[model samples]
Target: MKKFIIAPSVLSANYMNLKNDLTQCLENDINWIHYDVMDYDFVPNLTFGSKILQDITSQIKMNIDIHFMVKVKTKNFTDFFVEYIKANPQMMTMHIESMNAKETKLFIDLCKKNNIKASLAVSPQTPIKKIIKYLPIIDNILVMTVEPGFGGQSFIEHAAGKIGLLRKIIDQNNYKTTIEVDGGINSETSKIVKDYGVDIIVAGSYLFGQKDFAQRAKKLAGGN
Candidate 1:
């Protein structure tokens, strides 16, 4: 079995003490940080951008897993992509619904040029087959267990099937790709995803909402 990674999403962290929250994760031996970049147009909520990401990464040396929740057709989408790429996150995931074939290839190529792992994200309602063609090229696939817009939602149980199918496809093709799941992930949901072959777990409210982040993180990572 693959060792599951516990990535605490900064979206649910206390904004005023963001640095402390992130540092706490590192202190607890958790290395991956899930950063959600939302542009009000694609999703209903708007989130922080590259400058903030740079600031956090400068202070804390953690593996940054950025999820881009924005529309590709937006006027400044490229600008946003370039700026984020400059931050040099370990991995970056863009929504499959936002880009077409050409745009997807362009995004993946940019990540390769910069030596950053590129990933495709699929919403809860999206079919698993939507990203099959790109599986061999991308480094990872982020399966959203809940709707993309907000956090603290219940896990969509049916998404587990998608995770299973993705794992089978990756194994059958011997692709060097990983599977990551985000949104509404708690201790229970973590088990479900892990059983289905999720390599990384992105937990927002469930991990950050409680006072004991380390304890929650350990549980989510399948540690006792």
Candidate 2:
């Protein structure tokens, strides 16, 4: 069986002790430390940037996975993020829907040149086909269960079919890309999602919000 990578998203971490919060993710054997780098243009909420990543790189040992939830601009932040990747970033990516086709390709190519793992995400409302058009250029697909920006929303049931369809498309086309599912991925629902064959699970509220945060994260890691 393929290994299930557990990436604990840090959007819900306590800002006061963000480094300490990341320390817990390191303790749990989580696969990657996910950063939700959002700008207000793409989504309603805006999240932290290189300042937070600087703190994380100075302290943590786990692999870094960046989800750039920002609108495509004059390569300002992307230039900053390329600098982040230079500091040994394991995975750095941006939103496909946030930029136009030409820009998306350019961004992915830039990330690849910088040796940062490139990925793209889609909201529950966007068609998976739009994402597939860019698949040959990207490395992973972040399929959202809940809407971006905020957590604590119910998982949309309709997304299950989309996941299954994406799986078929990936396999048939021989794409070596990972299928990552974020939001609402708890132990119970995660097991159910096993049927859809996701490779990475990005857990946010489900991980950091728990009392026994480390063990709960390992539990969601699902049997090694």
* Alpha-carbon TM-score of each model against the true structure: 0.95, 0.91
lDDT of 2 by residue, 1-224 (tens): 56788888888788787777777776777648788888898888988877668767776677888887878566553564555665577787666678777777777887788777788888888899788877777888888888888766677767755778888889999998888888787777787566788888888888775798867876777653
- lDDT score, candidate 1: 0.87
- Candidate 1 wrong stretches, greater than 4 Å: 73-77
C-alpha lDDT score of every prediction, in listed order = 0.87, 0.77
Number of the predicted model whose lDDT against the real structure is largest: 1
* Clash totals, every prediction: 0, 0
Q: After superposition, how far is residue 154 of candidate 2 from its true place, in Å?
A: 1.7
Task: For model 1, name the residue pairs that clash.
Answer: none
Model 1 lDDT per residue over 37-141, tens place: 998988999999899998887777899999999886656445558878777799999999988887888889888988999999999899988899999899999
C-alpha-based local distance difference test score of model 2: 0.77
Shift of residue 125 alpha carbon in model 2, Å: 0.8
